[model samples]
Target chain A: MGNPAFDILSILPFAVACSFGMLILLLEVFQRQTASRSYLAGIAVVGFLLTAFVSGSFLPTGTARATFGGMAWIDGYTQIFTSLFCLAGALTAMIAPRYLQEHGADRGEFYALLLFSVAGMIMMVAAADLVVFFVALEIMSIAVYALAAYTRRSKLSSEAGFKYFVLGAFASAILLYGIALVYGATGTTNLAAIGQAFGGDVARGATGDAAAMSTLAQNAIVAAARGADVSVAAVIGNTGAGAVPLAILGATLILIAFSFKIAAVPFHMWAPDAYTGAPTPVVGFMAAAVKAAGVAALFRVVSVALFSDSFRGGEYGWVQIFFALALLSMVVGNLVALVQGNIKRMLAYSSVAHAGYMLVAFTAVGFRGGDISMGSGLVFYLFAYTIATIGAFGVLSWLGSRGMPCDNFEDLDGVGYRYPWIGLAMSIFMLSAAGIPPAAGFIGKFLVFKSAVAASAAGGPGSGLLIFLVVTGILVSVAGVYYYLRVIVHLYMKKATREVPEMPYGAARWAIVICAVLTLALGVLPGKLVNSSEQAVGQMAGRADGVYQQSAEAPLPTPGGIRLIR
Target chain B: MAETIFFIVFALGALGFSAAVLIAKNPINSAVMLVCSFFCLAGIYVMLSATFMAVIQILVYAGAIMVLFIFVLMLLNIRDDEIEAPRLSIHQGIAILAGTGIFFTIALSIAAWSGSSSRVAHDTMSDTFGTVEPIGDQLITSYVLPFEMAAILLLVGIVGAVVVAKKRF
Candidate 1:
């Protein structure tokens, strides 16, 4: 009983990652005298790094348990998300001081809000129950909404924050409705309990499903068609091993909400406007931390809980819809980025494209064969994406110095010649993002291709998907090469119209430098990082007897929810 | 009979107060009305056997957070004229149509469609079914960490809010 709630701890890293900011805030608000801002920044960075180290330490132990009457699950999947959230937060915190002091917008509360937001993110990732999840989502979102509009003077920033809040609320409402449907269908809010309920329905088969009682849960109708209790011959609909179709619907709604948060295509309208409009450091956090949580949690919710039962009879719209979105994101993200004159908007599109690439791997999750390798590929891609995105934003922040908002491609003109170190770092970041070798991005994409190919090689029909992904992969990367290079072109070829931004010798630049170095390190040591991710993925999909249940039983959408009254 | 009466009063109260939020066209009035609507929601929560939820609805939301929102509105000194600031015709119309359509559709759909429900026929609160004690039990044990974490998060949020909103910090 060391605390089944340790899953709660698994998600704690993100919050802990932001504690330094809070400490700074406490002094600013309560002490009447605040610590030196630089000192506070140092504390924040150190604290975040420490949190990262601690959370990373939790990865190897594959312990799973139900906490407090099954309200939350602390498991390997939770651990993965916690690690990703903390890593993003720590990196952002490390960079914020320079980012803050530069714009004259960085205040003590900025750091505090950042920490509070991170804490909310941690709780959200670990929320096992729907209510808890909704609460946590709000906690995380409101903090971000504020951060998005942190600069009071910037009309664009305020507008971006307002728009994000409005749309985000709309998305949350959809998600809540979906959650309501799920509760009506299953009569439970706990994910594990939902599984049990579905499992029972499946065990009882078609008769139990159609004949069951519980007017409050009309769609749990699978219950009513038979006798009030059970009969031996009620095994028809249980043809599959699980209640998947309904599960799929619930998962899809979750996907839409998560997609909104992460900024995937079709679902990505808010991102470019938001990113271009928000103050820059907030962009860094949103791009890195918000997207990381979305992808990580998506992988967990879909791949772990639902995958146990779903993926059969082609009902989940799994292969086709995801493939389309992924393809669209990849092609559209790159294409749009190319046309964008605003560097921030360009980066926003690049994120969309990167999300597309990640979605491409996620398609593997929906592909008939539940190949564990694809999970690893997705994780690798995430790590690579995180580093590159952060670095890219860092350089952008550097470009926009002393109340200067970096608005257009022209803003970057002549920076390569003027600020060589920072320019070179940005080049590395852009190249890595474009999947060039000797950069983390290339290794990540390579791993994904290899994994998809490996699964196809194993005599499964993943070959069709493999081919489609490979072709798109090559095509999108080629399409992507130009936009990234365009920045470099602006940096080197164009004349410096403004005074060469005296190489921003600050914490933010150092942060960008560190991330660039790590990108290379990951490229060089792809094996080590890949192995860790592979192991984490293995732990995540948890060996339910080593056999990848060739066909899983899934629940279809109930067509309706619980009939609350008889 | 009591359940029916309670449901009517609370539901009507919620609807009425929420309507006040919308019809007033003033952000401050809307926020205060929202607080009243929240109280109605808490009443509904009580009827649902979610006693603690009702308390939290009132305490965290109506009691604490709404104050922050109103304070911000007052501090910003946003005038009545500024409240309905200029909007792009296309964008503003899109927002209005979308919002109206959604609210109307949801109300219509719920009215037309009778969804499934779980019957908690047993009416009395015992050791379970949402008393302060049960919620307390669950919070400390199952939701213990999240409960604690929520407090800490709120604390951080308070500090952050002061920092961001306060001129000096």
Candidate 2:
């Protein structure tokens, strides 16, 4: 307990960022006696970049280890997601000071809140215990709730904040209830313990119809058996209870909560309003980082915790649900976006469609009979998605003045001529978002779709659906190009009428350029990213040996943690 | 036996107060009842053996938060008088619909799959409920953030109360 983060010192970068954020707050508060707050801003940026590099080093080969007495865990999956979070945080922090200072809302707390949120997200991915997970989620959420309404006088910002908070609370409540039920079913709040519960089913021949589960189940039972139980039969009964429908309900409720985060269809009511109403820089943060974390968490929880033939009692039915969600999201998001006049709203819908593409990667992750593959592809896709989205939002933010808000198609009428680099970077972002080649988004979609095609050839339960997914992926992408190009059409195709009010060429320009470069870099060299993903998939599947295992960071109280056994 | 009684009482109290809060038209009354609801929740904590949390609930939520609320009401002293009416605004409608959708989805979905076998047979008395010592030990060691939130909450409470209490300082 001396250093709670010591067990997973690999995640020290996240902690350091959090500390840097606090220091930024303190530095700004006392900077009246010293030089400019810009110095502190530079320090924050440098700290984050160093942290980003350190985390990136971990990405070459995913290392799965637990830290802080099993409270926080850093494995291959956590490594990839944490890297994504850090990069997004770094990008947002880079531009935030100048952008916020331009409008007079430039407080040190803004950076602190952003850093804290990133810290929250990092812990979220690494959380081995329910308490830690929930706390991490809250820390991230509360910060953003304020950020969404940062523009106090703007009625839209206020309304957006209200809508997001209320809906977010409701979803959080549902998620908590799900956690309670999962704890009830498994008796252990520890993920490692929960995974082992699946092994228990394999013990009593509860493998249902999936013979492929035998190996995972055997390994899980062996791993779970290593941990002493206060009540053996209770543990077995809970394991046996996996055959019950409550497990599915728990998984579904959790899914519903995550779907909201990813802005997936049906649960995506909050995203457009929140995105459109928020200030542009905050919108960039939401579109890129918040949404990425949501999807990453969904990937971690659904794949690692639920989604098994034995656990769900032969109901590995998310293949169709994901298929439908992907199709519906692509169709609905792209279609609605085509008619949208607001540029930010259009990008929000584009973000939704991007979620669909990622879902395709997730769908391809598990084989029909249940072997997993192309996990690294999903990570690469996320990395691409994060870079491109943040880049798009940054351009939009720069174009938007405090009064104008840069939302409508007309806002960018002559923006391309005024800010040529921004125009090109935004075009690249739009192209990448549309899945055009030579950008990260293109390669990401390619790997995801290729894996889906492979998954289909393997003759999973829904080859027909995978085929459908593949077709819609192409068709939906065509729709995506239309909306993305509409902005391009406004930018270069149309001529500027009024003088484009230009700010000093400083931080925003640099951020957009860096984002554009990263997008291109990721597009060209995605091997390391994919390898990270591969390691992550192993850790996620590694827990399949036993659902949840206790590590140093988060140790489960024998009776308190696992209620299914009680 | 004790736990069963505690569960029954706490469950009833939680449901009843929540319902009252929902139905009550008076904003002031609603706020007061909400405080009561929090107290009842603190009672449930005693049953769960989280004594420190029980004290925290009554002192912070029931005592401090409620008084601050009352003070604001008196300070404003709206001419509209003792009974504050509730509005069925769009937010309320959205809230109701959302709550209903979630409740139906969860309740009906679980109901459909509830196999007729009730496998819930355990000796509640025999189970050694986690004592405050362990809870404290765990909170300090593993849950330091949430524990630190006590200070944040106090800070927020003081700041928020002051901000609201003084129109402009």
User: Which candidate leads in TM-score?
Assistant: 2
Expressed as tens digits, the lDDT of each residue in A291-319 for candidate 2 is: 87877766666555554434422254665
TM-score of chain A considered alone, across all candidate predictions: 0.83, 0.88
lDDT of 1: 0.66
Q: Can you give the DockQ of every candidate in the order shown?
A: 0.16, 0.24
Residues B1-169 of candidate 1: C-alpha lDDT, one tens digit per residue:
9999999999999999998997887788899999999999999998886777888898999989998999988888777777674556998899899889866755543332233222234432244556566456445654555576676657755653543465533
Can you write out model 1's per-residue Cα lDDT over A1-566, one digit (the tens) per residue? Answer: 12232444545465565566557666655443433465566666666666656665854466554443344445555666666666666667666666566655656666667666766666565565666666677667778887887775667877888788889988898788767755544545655444444434422332335345322233233335432211111212222222333444455666788888888888899999899888777788898778877777666555544443433212446566667778888888888988998988999999998888887777765564445557788888888888888888887876786656666878888888888888898899998999998999999988776765665565555567666876887797898899999988988999976553553436777788888998989988899778778776766432232322111222221221112222
Model 1 DockQ (Cα-based): 0.16
Which parts of model 2 are misplaced by more than 4 Å?
Answer: A1-10, A33-36, A54-62, A202-243, A312-316, A366-370, A498-505, A539-542, A545-566, B1-13, B39-61, B64-128, B141-169
- Every candidate's lDDT: 0.66, 0.68
Alpha-carbon RMSD, each predicted model: 6.8, 5.0
True interface contacts reproduced by each model, as a fraction? 0.12, 0.11
